[model samples]
Target: MSVLSRLFARHVKPEFGKPGPRQEGGDLPPHLYGVIAEFGKPETLVHAVHATRKEGYQVIEAYTPYPIEELHDAIGHGPSRVPLLVLIGGIVGGLFGFFLQYWTSVVAYPLNVGGRPYNSWVSFIPITFECTILFAGIAAVLGMLVLNGLPMPYHPVFSVPRFQLASRDRYFLLILARDPRFRAGDTFRFMETLGASLVSDVED
Candidate 1:
């Protein structure tokens, strides 16, 4: 190859070639502060969450099929204020809807065809309600997606073979070593004692 071609080749990725295996190293082991244990039954899972908390693991998250109200109490998660966002969206939409109708009917084209008032409050109520609902629904969907970091094409949890069980009646407790009081080896040993079925290092 010419000098220019060789230089360009350095930046290009090779296609369909036998690449060398990756040397697995430098992955953060589990939380290094706490381990996650999965439970077969709901009661067992709930008990586990309570147990883990008593053991002093600061960070914990539980995934279930439906809303488990008691689980939040067990894990100490605060009430999410996402509904406040929907309310704000609804208020804004209602105001905008009213303004649009007012501008068009009363100011832009004022025609009293059937002896009806230009600023007809009754006529605008339905439109206002529709706009309020529309904005609230849109906000809820978008807010949830944004907060969840959705459309997540890539996630470290996917690398774990058993994590897929989350959707299928399996409960998991993830303790992030990112907490202020986390230590790796001590955390791993604690998790093992907590009856973790399979404890492997969770990679971010």
Candidate 2:
């Protein structure tokens, strides 16, 4: 097996209820390991995120029932530029919309009826404004999804049973031990001291 696969196999547990012979060995290879901690209350979960961040683990993920603004800081996620992208796209769309109508009225079709001027300014405003909104809305949604890497229906972390509770009332902080400084036994021991309800090695 590759080093990454070996590391994952060593840490993540198989299906929670399945019975199998436990493998005994020395230290596991380096790979991402998630340590799940269950909390009864939102405050408890928030505390766990903060505590885990202070533990020096760089790779961490948190699951919660509702949006928690402070959690972004805990995970070290920086400000998102999706809004800015949408704004710029809207500006470009507005200009494109105006040009499309202008070209069609003046050069392409040039339907001058009832002594009306070929370059009609008032007639183009409605369509130009609508196009601006449509493009900007589309850009905002697609940009956010791409920036966040969305549409992933499955994650290795979801293989853990207790982690399923994350969508409900529970909060979870998973620290990936695959980081450069990760020491399997030492990290496990340290989490135990952090008052984790149940700290277990996650295996792939």
Q: Number of the top candidate by lDDT? A: 2
**Top-scoring candidate (TM-score):** 2
Deviating ranges (above 4 Å) for candidate 1: 1-35, 65-69
Q: What is the lDDT of candidate 2?
A: 0.69
C-alpha lDDT of candidate 1 relative to the true structure:
0.66
Worst 10 residues of 2 by lDDT: 16-25
TM for every model, in the order presented, reads 0.74, 0.75
Kindly provide the TM-score of model 1 when superposed on the true structure, using C-alpha atoms.
Answer: 0.74
Q: After superposition, how far is residue 81 of candidate 1 from its true place, in Å?
A: 2.1
lDDT of each: 0.66, 0.69
Model 2, runs deviating above 4 Å: 1-26, 30-33, 178-181
